[model samples]
Target chain A: MNFSSFPKESVKVEEVIDCIPVGVAVLDTNLRLQAMNRALEAMTGFSREEAIGIDCSHIIRNNLCTQKCPAKQVLENDRAVHLEGNIVNRERQKIPVMIHASVLKDDEGKPLGVIETIEDISLLRELDKKTRITHDFADLVGHSPKMQKLLEILPIISQTDSSVLITGETGTGKDLIASVIHRVSPRAQGPFVKINCGALPETLLESELFGHTRGAFTGAVRDKPGRFQLADGGTLYLTEIGDLPLTLQVKLLTFLDDKEIIPLGGTRSARADVRLIAATHRDLQAMVRQGNFREDLLFRLNVVRLEVPPLRERQGDIRLLMEYFLNKFNRQFQKKIKGFSPEAIEILRQYPYPGNVRELANMVEYATNVCHESIIKQEHLPDYLGGPWDEALRPEVRATVGEMGSYPGLEESIGKRVADNRLNWREMERRMISEALVKSRGNRTKAAKILGWGRSTLWRKMKQHNLV
Target chain B: MSEKLLITIWRDQVAPRFDLTSEVLVATVDSTGEPLHSKTVVLPTVSAEDLCHMILTEGINTVICGGIEEEYFEYLSWKKVKVIDSVIGPYLQALELARVGKLEPGAILREEASQG
Candidate 1:
């Protein structure tokens, strides 16, 4: 409704500006304060009487006032300008504020003065900081018993400067744990240098861990600082430590003992004050037993160890992790998806996550990117997780599962999925192995021949499937 | 009764902030509080620590500035220097006030405001 057509009520300009709950200052063409509301007085700690003849820059003491000012833009461009800036108050405390400056016009379109509004955003900034601090602690979100116990001890472990060994299966978040340790440790402000021992060959891996002098070997044209030198006064996180060659292992042990690195082709040793954190998916003890790894090096690196559990073993964390990743993907893709449907949740719960949290995170990211509707349904899940299983649990597979004696629980579970016409491949492999064993009449060599496999392959499969 | 004073300056007006001021007026006052000699020193850049160093090295006993934070205030105080902060407007007027021992903290001395 137009005010001229409705009614012309007497409303005081000062009262209107005061009741708006923001600082309002009216400045002349000279940008000197002409008038201001009570809120401006409170925001700036300068009363209207003392601030009237003074320049607004002196009163506000903001970073932008000496630069291309908003009020000047309003007068020059004849339009409003909005900006974010910080102002120093009378007490010397800094406050974040959003400013809106517009021109106040007289009759017949003549510009009179500039009207500026300031909104303090300290509370909003504090809330944003709080949310980031909690969710961004290496994104370690979980509630299962295993995860909760790990979380409870992470702080205590991070306080020390010992070599940490983080062992977990692929995609089980061992790298995240390593980062969290460095972030919370006393060396937090120091650099965190990471190198994948498996990513490079033995020659390059050696030069990468310890610095090399010029002309150390081919392609060694320049002097280089390795991870140890780069991580001076910090941490060096060696991932896939199991992949490190035995020669490099002895050198690493020497560095850990002497705190010195004699770079390749360099005669003198340089000291490096570095803490070490190592991670791997392979079992170092098994590798040692096979004579492929150094047992003494393993003992040195295992001063403090963190074993991250797999996603399937963390039964209570599946839904939480799925929702967390879904929310994360929603933010990344700029979508407002609520959550997964009940049917999708049921499928996700039943499906085994052999690749652990990383796989689940990827699945959620894919579904969130493709899902157009408000809620994610079972159809939105990856095909390998959904309907492919509907045709997998055949009658023949169920008959074989039934013939496998003394595992009624497995039989019943597969039997239930068989009626539902869905089964994972691991169960099917177990049943096939049992059939091979029955056909061979407990002869390992005959069972290996029946399965068209090596004797050790059959033995490892038996151990994995608990057929022994 | 002779004393030395430093006024952070911008053009003829006192700078709105001490941290942003690039030049400062250093004056040596006599027994009656009148200036014996005055000089304007241009700084390399705007830095609070450099300005504080200049204040100490120049043997300035008092400082007239605009909008100084508590940290610099306490530091200057701890060093036995008196800081008259939050004083706005022309440097001459502020210098005159200091000459008469009348310049106080948070003093506003703008001449006219409504010049379009």
Candidate 2:
């Protein structure tokens, strides 16, 4: 083949430029497209032949073309110009791009044309936005030292396909962290299947986790795929793993060993490509020692254990979570309650929320609903907080109250009524409803609002208690 | 049968990129290639999906543009619209070729005198 007939230097230059990953375009002094690499052709959806002899602006229709032409700038200044802009591609999607343009000079140092390189930064921009929203990890919101450490390791853990075990008290956001791990993992695009092992009985839980074929059991009328099958190519979050029965634990251990699941009453085992993430509020180690949990299964799941700090331990995040939920509920319920009063905030800070962040969120929600004024007051809180400061200090400090001042009003009222053999919860509820109705001038809706109960709920309660 | 043909336009020539073109010329031509009605439409913003919707809504049978992505090309093809893409030349010449049904894909119809 007479390869010499081809312009060797031009062909070599084209090949070299084409090999470059980023889009590159060469324009003549008149800003007409003289040449462009395959990357540029793909980026702009303009073929080399179609792009040649056309205005570069027409080929690369970018925001900068009309506003700040880097090529034109380079030509005028005889220097390199760099810019970040967006280009509308063939799909009409605006791709964030960075362009570097420099004047192409001849041997005589006279400007011949301009060479420009374009890079698509859309993915980088998307990651930057995600990082901002996640505060380093996806959906894991906390800046406390413990949370910060967890966030630091979350990315590293997400990179692997190993089984993860997250241990935290109830309402400490274990599910949230599990999902964040899945979202940050390579299998983010795949399904994230979650099941509470404790929520179902042993027989039902087995079928739920490993699926069941038709006629597998008495009620198995049709073939059903389970969590493992649903989470193929993704992550399966098994919450409350401590409650998994011993027989189910053995099966789970087998599945973990072989990455295969045998559906109930099925003779054959099928492969499942799923990353397992387990969570439990109970002490699995103690369960293992007590023979309630299998040691082998524990070893398999406890390869990496992440402990989520309780809300009381991370005191710094209390206000942050309060403000976050306040904003969130404000948008949801259309209320503009400014914030908690100083006394109310002090009470919240001193209170040891055994239910963790979930309890705090509920408290804020209740306050937001009952608060008629700009700020959340102590009176707006749930009665569990006790009547007032004096009422809270009367009782000996309860274990559940932590080191905070005691909630004496709740204890005294319940204690006195129980001691007198007259602590009828029904009677007390009826009296409370009657009081609320009288305060609202017998208006059920106003009464419901005052009591922080939905109108339908108040109506149902009234019917149940014969208050209507 | 009178058929509608749409051409993406830029300046006096066909737009070099289909998705970037903000203006289009739609012409209704008779079986003999004689123009029955012709109008130029300007889009509020350039968008390929919007343009596809417009094409479907306007009952355009043929589309003439410069370059197009494979997905949009396949989409319009799937919708049974004839797409003559990668065309480079003055708009009138391309329009004339389309009228006679002689225009080919990747056709470079710019005369030597008109070459830049």
Candidate 3:
């Protein structure tokens, strides 16, 4: 009789033995089992019955694996051992397994019993092993000189334990810089705390930064650790530092000056071993002069300043960022989009990113969801990102005045533009003066010569424009 | 490029409600029409005060949002971000009006509005 032609029960038992998901055992060194299929349960019919008390030799046709048996390698060596698919079943089929074995030894190190666990990874074996690359840091993609300079300095910045101030446009990844600093720092093992100064109200911001005790205010019921306290022994990052209220500026400065915090409604101060990193898109120096920000605090925070260039300024990074986000959203939304069309990429490159990196990511994610084809075309992006073909591509510059005519409407359109006009003029003159100044390298005479203006006229213009 | 014209536009509630705080946008031409830079700054209370301070201390020339209060106009005139008061409209239209030197003060400057 062919064992292959055995009844369904026998075949089921055989399948259980040969194809059991994980490792199984029927044993008796002296704890006798009448019969077993495999030294490692090669074929699985034994479900706590039929094989218990059966002799191993009669089933597997192999005696109790001794010191030399491959199965007992770990036990014999008295060391932890690992095994892969090596065990053979009664059906002579091989099955994948990982056996972690350690000796069950007596007090004198004499062997007593042996045990091992097994894990099957046949599914893993069948898989093609697709590579998974995360896009978390991919968000920080850039290869421009400015970005390269930043990347080079990031490790250096991380090495130092000084307070850092990051300045850039709104979406220029100032937070990314802080995070990268924390990740690359010696204190990487410590927690990284982030707070948006612009997001919270002044009253809540104080409590959020320094934490508060029970009965501190109407909302405080229990003692809570503020961001500074929670970030102790780590790094605390404050974004939009320019928006911080004047009242909190004093307290924040005190914390930075001395590594101590006074919690709301708490009597004494507590030490907080945290590194401070602050960022803002605004001109803090101007704020300092205006007395909105404390000059002393600005000095404390600007110990090491890192400037993140805006996306439009670093056009080289656009393609890379687009691809990174495309691949990410593809995997995320489980779409089969190939990539962006060349035209689409061109449009992205040419478009001045007013909103910067965060906006680019949002646009890419939106395009991925809306586009019908495998590749994203220019049309798939929002109208603002496209060219003149789309009406929304340009800023709302009305031909005639008083079109909207409402106070706020007029304010939004006209007010900003009038300011833009004067700024545009000043900017133009400033740029010309600077270019002339740079070429002349601080030579008032040569700058006058290059611009072809009379020496007195140049001097007067410099004084009037404050370019001197 | 004929030196790109830089203009500062202002509106009555522009500074307080949004970050119209010295946001400089470039004026360029595409196929459609006059295009301004996309970025804008909303002056914070402190920064607004700072802008006011610049006029006082540094004597920096300022382009006000359309129709600043009289005292602010007076204070700014005294301090000097050369308060260019004009009628509020679309940014380009406002700039054009300022460019031709046709922009005129729409209302008498008030001390109360300036204090706020």
Please tell me which predicted candidate would have the highest TM-score against the true structure: 2
Ranking by TM-score: 2, 1, 3
Query: For each predicted model, how many residue pairs clash, with residues at least 3 apart or on different chains?
Result: 0, 1, 49
Clashing pairs in 2: B66-B86
Write the residue-wise lDDT of candidate 2 on B4-116 in tens digits.
Answer: 99999877788767776799999999999999989999986576877999999999999998767677888999999999987767777888999998999877774621353
Worst 10 residues of 2 chain A by lDDT: A393-402
**Top-scoring candidate (lDDT):** 1
CA-based DockQ, model 3: 0.00
Model 3 TM-score (2 dp): 0.46
TM-score attained by chain A of model 3: 0.56
DockQ each candidate and list the results. 0.34, 0.07, 0.00
lDDT of 1 by residue, A1-468 (tens): 111221122135566787879899877677777678898899888988888767888898876887778998888999999998878777777788999999877556767678899989989977865564455463998899999989988888888988999998777899988988887777876899999999998888888899799999988899998899999879999999999999999999999888898898889888888999999988899999999889899999999989998877896799999888988899999999999899999988886555678778878997998899999998898776755443334344355444334344666666677655534566787887899999999898998999999999999989988987
- Stretches of candidate 1 exceeding 4 Å from the true structure: A1-16, A132-138, A143-323, A326-360, A363-468, B1-5, B19-61, B75-80, B112-116
Tell me which of candidates 1 and 2 scores higher on lDDT.
Answer: 1
Candidate 2 residue lDDT tens string, A1-468: 112222335456667799899999877777877778999888877788776766776677666774478988998888899899877555545678999999877667777788899999989979875774376353466789998898888889988999999998777899988988888787887899999998998899999999999999998999898899999989999999999999999999999999999999888898888999999988888898899999989999988999999887785889888888888788888998999888888888877665678778888898888988999898998776754432332122222233223334555544553444433667888898999999999999999999999999999989989887
After superposing candidate 2, which stretches have Cα over 4 Å from the reference? A1-139, A387-468, B1-116
lDDT (0-100) at residue B37 of candidate 1? 92
For model 1, report DockQ.
Answer: 0.34
